[model samples]
Target: MPGQLFCFGFGYTAEHLAARLLPLGWKIAGTAREADKRAAMQAQGIDAHPFPLPDPAQALAGVTHILSSVPPRDGHDPVLAAHGGTIAALPDLVWAGYLSTTGVYGDAGGAWVDEDSPLNPSSPSGKARVAAEAEWQALDLHLHIFRLSGIYGPGRSAIDQLRAGTAKRIARPGQLFNRIHVEDIAAALAASMAHPNPGAIYNLADDEPASSSDVVSHASTLLGVAPPPEIPLEQANLSAMGRAFYAESKRIRNDRIKRDLGLTLAYPTYREGLAACLSGAVSN
Candidate 1:
């Protein structure tokens, strides 16, 4: 099952997944938008190529699995537009995964949302994801959709934000956000690769959906620093993107991944996840 895995956007999540699969004898190759990033990946032994792959067929010659973490561009998926035909023609392609956002289920009013929940996206990015998902589902391939929650791990966690003095405790009463560790996301993806279930939609989130202030405060406690003062959402002086994120809140459900893929998250909540980040205990 570990033949060749090609990732469309080999960024943070894809890098973590590669860390797991590479050790299992899988040949890893992917595209990065920046030449420097491509060079870094190639230096780390990945067969990295630039985005908008110059020769799609030649690059994807022996790929058994494909994962696309690329976001939509101008209301359409770039990967499908560029290489959908070639990918559909691959004879030995076994599984294909698309990393989507749980934001598609926008502003559940902090209510729980599962794979069956109806999509009501409020942001342009979320709407683009809905369209991209439809396009992927339309293709004749073994596809699995992973609607990921806020991904946090290692250098991307609240601890790092606090250390960088960018940790904000914006107060939106009753607003909660769901999060998942990158390692857990990699684990779930690996489990799904082992048990390929076509047409499945899984939510990749942790057990707890907590407020942003709570997460920041916990990270502060771990770092032995005073938590930043909480500012009301309206007075937070956030950018449009930040305000847009604060406007919607939802508690994502992850029962399907556990039931279908038999995955148990290593860091089940922000507390354990931030602790691991502080202790530098991240592992594959």
Candidate 2:
């Protein structure tokens, strides 16, 4: 039978996953915060509706898979709060996925952390994710949680930042952050669907972990332009969320995704990822 996938948040990551599954005859439905975005998705043949799920039972009637990319707001997961009962009661549901951030591992002193790492989220958002993860686990379903690293893709990568002249080389010594290409994220999700493991937690991150300044420099080089001047972490002016990103430094281990799911990343490092984005732009 063809799969019916419903996403709680049809943002960048979910869109990539949907694109991959659509070719395989999957029926995709999702929620958008704004009516305009929902209409836009409907225009593209997607059954997207404004969130808070108007008709929970009706909307999730034939949904075999559920993917939640919505972040916790005010210490609550909107999806669970709104339609937890409806989703739990769905007899047709097989796989349930929640998108989490690697920040849940907190500051690891630049050390390697895996699925077994103790979650000690430092920022407010990270703390909320920890809470949401626990909440989702309480539901009796085939739940699979993914702790994603910094997400970057074609329109949302260092290449775009550098080209837009908004890229900043923030120098934070010993700060190694892991990142995952959006395509790789979609690949991993698809792989999990092929081999469903209930209660499994996977870290979705690239093999290489580098500093922000290094990524900026590499992106500038790819664009054939001088990199932005380096700004020391102490002197850099950043919003609360932005500064919180640098507060945690951990190299996430992705061996579980490879070993268990039998999957390999297409862009294993920032170099390949940035280069691909640049080439893709040129070709387009």
Each model's lDDT comes to 0.93, 0.91
- Any residue pairs clashing in model 1, and if so which? none
lDDT, residue 221, candidate 2: 90
Question: Can you write out model 1's per-residue Cα lDDT over 1-284, one digit (the tens) per residue?
Answer: 57799999999999999999888889999999898999999987899998788999899998999999999999999999999999999988999999999988888998999999999999888899999999999999999999998999989999999999999999899899899999999999999899999999999999999999999999999999999999999888898867888999889889998899999889999998999999999855
lDDT of 2 by residue, 24-125 (tens): 889999999888989888886789977898788888999999999999989988899999989999999899999999999999999999999999999999
- Work out the TM-score per prediction: 0.98, 0.97
lDDT of 2: 0.91
Check candidate 2 and list the clashing pairs: none
Q: Runs in model 1 with CA error above 4 Å?
A: none
Q: Which stretches of candidate 2 lie over 4 Å from their true place?
A: 281-284
Worst 10 residues of 1 by lDDT: 236-245
